[model samples]
Target: MLEIGGVSVEDHLWGGRIMVDLPLACWVILLLEYLDTFRLEVELIWPAKWGLVKLLYVLDRFLPFVILPFVGFYNITANPSSDFCRILFAIPCMGIIACIFIAEAILYLRVFALSGRSRTILVVILINGIVVVATCCALLARYIALATWDIPRPPGVSGCKGTFTDGKLVMIGYGTTLYSGILVAVLCVYFGIRLYWSRRPGRIITIFYRDGTMYFIALSVMSITNVVIAANLPTGFRFLMAPFQGVLTSSLSIRMVLRLRQGAREDMGLTTVKVPDIEFTPETSGIAMDVPRTRLGA
Candidate 1:
């Protein structure tokens, strides 16, 4: 192993090169994105009036922004051997799983509204979502159990890394990737059919079309990237995947919520959009409501 100015080259898992810099950059960029949009998040989904669904939305959208930075900083500054750091690691792990839960819940509500609140559709989607999320949690548990601290990097590099102890654990990640990709594809098809039938799409349907399509594409790309990285990269390098995923998940979830609320505001003659009920059920609970009003459209 080469020594550079007395620093051992093997001190970093990725040769102490650009790979060491990437996660820091990723954290900075993701944190900045969260900070930039937070004002709008607060305005639209104010906690003062948060219901159960809105509460979940807050946890999904903001929790990553809050927890990830701690994880990043800890990885850089704290001794991994310390009991406290190990204990603290649980926060991000749990936070990440919680965020996924909230995001999927929001997505399910969105589809149910789009499907005119049909009981059959909601039941099917709920069952599928539960299965998918439970599988993800099981995989995540394996990952956490097997996770290891990366070799400490030199100054100016972050080292918060974790990976599966067994290659089989990676197949679980592949399962998650498949689950996410399929979910996004189905949403795309749902919106595509809705857009087709509308013929003359209104502002609301147009918003849903634009937002859901772009978000789906973004998620699909992320899922593909996760698969590639997990399949090809070393276990230490695989830690890179979750930061990007967390950032994208938070941004998409919060932004889509903002857009839906924005359209609802315009429809209601409000100057600034506040959180409207995106998760609406029909009066009869099983009856199909009018799609337009049930949707976030005018």
Candidate 2:
């Protein structure tokens, strides 16, 4: 029985295991949903938006199956100080951070795709990306250092240990927590406004913005949870961190699947998930597409 800050490792691990299973189940369900969406997109939804949505959906499906399980399995199976396990675990954590960055970058591009090219939008995206990347890098560095220094294994923990005296790691963890919190808040506000405005005028914007907001919010919450876990919990309790990451990734994947399904439904007119597919014909090259009604009420 590992003990961290008076919490039993068995209890924590049990909870983590339960939570981790949620994502595994969710991933399978969402993968099927993604395939359905892919077929619909190819059959109905317009090419450009459908293609982008499909790509993101694929990433979502790939991560839970290909990336997350590896990390979780390694964490559970490998003994502490196993060089292979440590490297494997670190690679995926870094991959998670990288995936988040890619998601954010794609969000900006999706917005641009919807709103048309604008210098201001480009600037905003660049700035946000820089800040988020830097924050992730700091967190990664701290995680690596802690894992590498081989902090004293707290009683009952089953895997790699963390540094006890490393102020740097603590600081990095805290910084990551604070930075992620701030970033999420900003994104929420930004997307919230877009969602609101899109609704007020009943614009036919891609469902990407609405769904992206939800995804980011989930990610932000997970990041905050991780930061809190890292900062307050003992090293043995670190295993609990896996669930938060897993949940976040799973939530993102779900959102992608939902977006695809919604897009398909809208294309089929089965529901109100309408996203305008504006065509630029020679006769109406500059004419804007008719905005569809927002489904805010639904």
The most accurate candidate by TM-score is 1
Predicted structure 1: lDDT = 0.59
Tens-digit lDDT string for candidate 2 (122-240): 68767766776777677666666556434344555554433334334544643554464355446545644554454532222335445665766666666666657656765534434
Q: What TM-score, over all chains together, does every model reach?
A: 0.74, 0.60
* Model 2 residue 276 CA deviation in Å: 10
User: Where does candidate 1 stray beyond 4 Å?
Assistant: 2-23, 77-79, 82-91, 147-164, 191-199, 272-298
- What is the Cα-based lDDT of residue 82 in candidate 1? 37
Residues 114-192, candidate 1: write the lDDT tens digits. 6676688778877787777777777767666666554454455444444346545655655564576467559646754
Candidate 2 contains a number of clashing pairs equal to 1
Question: Which predicted model would earn the best lDDT?
Answer: 1
| Prediction 2 TM-score vs. true | 0.60
